[model samples]
Target: MRVLILGGTREARDLAAALVDEPGVTVTTSLAGRVRDPALPAGETVIGGFGGVAGLRAFLRARGIEAVVDATHPFAATMSAHAVAACAPPGHGDDPAGALAGDPAGPGSVPLLQLTRPGWTPGPGDDWHRARDLPAAADRARALCPPGRGVFVTTGRRQLAPFATDRDRHYLIRAVDPPTDVLPPRHTVVLDRGPYTVDGETRLLRAHDVRVLVTKDSGGALTVAKLDAARTLGLPVVMVDRPAATGPVPPTWPDVAGVLAALRGLAAGGQAAPPA
Candidate 1:
């Protein structure tokens, strides 16, 4: 069984590691290359984009990939949508959720799966304010945070221009990479990566005197400490909801183990055949 894993997140890496150990399974992981230095997965690895759906289809045919597992970040809606399009079976012409149309990889069905972690939910003692997008979140953050208190922004470095116009509150932006986009007039950048602890998150929040926490609902435990720290500090959070999924959905799982089980089932059933 040949497999292609559209990867970036830890889940994708773990899935690749697990699949490589399986008998008769040839696993290859593809990364978007947005990050400067990424934690590579076990087995064959391909860096950079496949261009688009047509390019992806050509790659799949050339590599003889039998199956695809899109274990990308929850916020990577475009890639996920493209995977559905590129792997769609014959005559799947409908585009309900504004998905980009894709060309099939080959003659027969090239089975695709998705692994997504569950989103965070507001619990007791959580002052949560949901925003439709980053612009909305920026507006809500300014309103909730007083002039003197700073706002901790963790919605990644990209697309931060939405918050640039709001200079009423000082912004403390944290990301794995330094943002290259237009930043707010008064803002500080902290270059860091996650899997952070609650204690560390609390200390960071305390040091900045952050009154408002702005982040995306990009689920998983790696960066969830910020949410917990905000709860402990009684800080209001302005969360940008995950974009509604567009395009044909695949067999989606919440964890690596579940995806492994499904792949085992596929291998047993000889679900996908390598393009000839």
Candidate 2:
């Protein structure tokens, strides 16, 4: 059995590790290579995009990938869309010709399992302002913070373009890589990765005296410390929502344990996951 994991998250790593040594299984993981030094998963790993949908389909066919598990970041809408199309049955995908958008023959060709963590829910003492996207979040941040006030931005490097022209508020940007996009006039980039602690997150927020916290809705328990820190200081958060999923919802597994079992079952039989 061959499996291709579209991975970059902790769950992806955990799943790859669990399946690497299983009998009759060959697991390969793919990364976007956005990070300078990404945490390597256990099995075979490939970096960078597989072009677009057509390229992905060729690669899938060439590699003889039996099953595909989409474990990309929740905000990775484009890649996720490509995965759906590439795995769709022949003449039933997002091709230039053939299948229309809602064709019944489309959706899944190879067995697909979705491994997505749930989004964070607002809790007591949380001052969360939901934004539709980065530009909207930037506007919300400007509204929440006074001129010359600090805004802590945990949104990734490539996402900084939307906030570039805003010169009123000072930004404390945190990302694993230095931002490639145009930056705000008054901003400091903190290159850091996380499985962060609330104590550390609190200290950073306190040090900057931030009035507003801006972050994406990339959810998982490991990354919730910043939200906790913001809540502790009674600061307002500009929570950018995840881009909506584009196609038919695939079978979903909330955690790595569930997906591991499902994939093993798939190797033994033909059915990989429960119905959508």
Candidate 3:
């Protein structure tokens, strides 16, 4: 059995690790190459984009990929749409009236599954402010804080432009790679990546005297420490909402274990059943 895993997140890594010992199964992990130094999975790997839907279809047909598992970030709606379009039958047409008119997938297409981690829910003593997008989150963060207050921003490097307009608030920005573009004059960039610890997060927050935290709702255990630290300090969080999936949505699993079980069943001659 051949599997192509669209990977970037921790769940994708876990799935790749889990499949290492499976008999007669070959796994190839594909990364988008957005991160400067992405952690490699334990299998054959390919880096960078496949052009678009047409390019992806050509590659899949050429490579004889039997199944596809889209384990990308929830915010990666464009890539998800392209995957669906690429997997559709040769003559499949787009849906003009649907949300994703540019891309569409027909029924009985290539087997595709989406592996997503559950979103975080606000618990007791947590002060959460939700925003529809990055701009909204930045505005909300500014509104929630007094002038010149420190804010911790962890919404990745690409989305920092909106927050850069707020010159009054000081920002402690954290990302895997350093930002190249100019930011707010009062901001400090912390070049790093996670699995962050609660102690480290708490110390960082306290040391910066962060009055607010601005982040995307990228729900996973790896970055949840920041949320925990914020809660402990009674700080307000401005969370940017995840973009809705475009085009035909594939069956989704919330964890790597469920995806592994489904893949194993498929390898054993069973149908590619949806994760329960």
Candidate 4:
């Protein structure tokens, strides 16, 4: 059986590692290649885009992929939709004269499984402002605080482009790695990941002279330590909500144990066999 795993997160790596050495399983993990220093997966790894649904379908057909597991970040809604569209049956409007969105039909369409981390919920005494999008988040950030105040941004590099597009405020940007593109004139980059301690984030905020923070709704204890740190410092945060996603939600496990169980079930039911 051959599986294509869409990954960039810890969950993605865990799933890929779990299936890498399984009997009769050939797992290929795909990364978006956005991170400057991305963590490598244990199995076959491919970096970059598959050109959306059409590209994904063709690749699946050619590679004889049996199943697709979308373990991308929760914010990667576009890629997640492509996986579903690639696997979805042709609509009534599909014409013989024209090709569909994804690849041509093969032995059968691939099955899709989703592995998403949940979003965080607000707690008492937390000063949180919600925004509809990145631009809105920026607007709220500016309106919520005064200039020259220290600010910590954890919204990832892609979204940061918009915030820095027309902003004149100074910021302390924290990400897993340095940004690929130019930042705002007054922005400073902090390369790190969290589970950051309260004192660690507090010191970071103080060191950068930040009075506010901005982040996405990527939920999980591993990355949420910043929230506690912010609250402890009495800093207000702007949290960008997650976009809607597609596919059947996979079971959540502390680690890869649950994913292994799901893989075992797929094998036992003979669903792991590649389509002819």
Ranking the candidates on lDDT from highest down gives 2, 1, 3, 4
What digit string (tens of lDDT, one per residue) describes model 3 on residues 16-65? 88787788878899999989899999999999999998888788888887
Error of 2 at 101 (Å): 17
Model 4 stretches with alpha carbons more than 4 Å out? 90-107, 165-168, 180-182, 246-258, 270-276
Stretches of model 3 off by over 4 angstroms after superposition:
93-108
Better of 1 and 4 by lDDT: 1
* lDDT score at residue 58, model 4, on the 0-100 scale: 84
CA lDDT, every model vs. true structure: 0.84, 0.84, 0.82, 0.73
Query: Model 1, poorest ten-residue lDDT window?
Result: 95-104
TM-score of predicted model 3?
0.92
Tell me each candidate's TM-score.
0.92, 0.92, 0.92, 0.83
Better of 2 and 3 by lDDT: 2
- CA lDDT, candidate 1, residue 267: 81
Clashing pairs in 3: none
| Least accurate 10 contiguous residues by lDDT in model 2 | 95-104
Steric overlap count per candidate: 0, 0, 0, 4
Model 3's C-alpha root-mean-square deviation from the true structure amounts to 3.5
Judge candidate 3 against the unseen true structure and give its global Cα lDDT, from 0 to 1: 0.82
TM-score of 2: 0.92
Question: How well is each residue in 1-276 modelled by candidate 2, as lDDT tens digits?
Answer: 899999999989999988887899999999998888999999899999889988888888889987888999999888888887787786666441211111224443576678999899889999999999999999889988999889999988886888888888888999988899899999999999888999999999988879999999999977799999999999999999998876656677888887877777777774554633
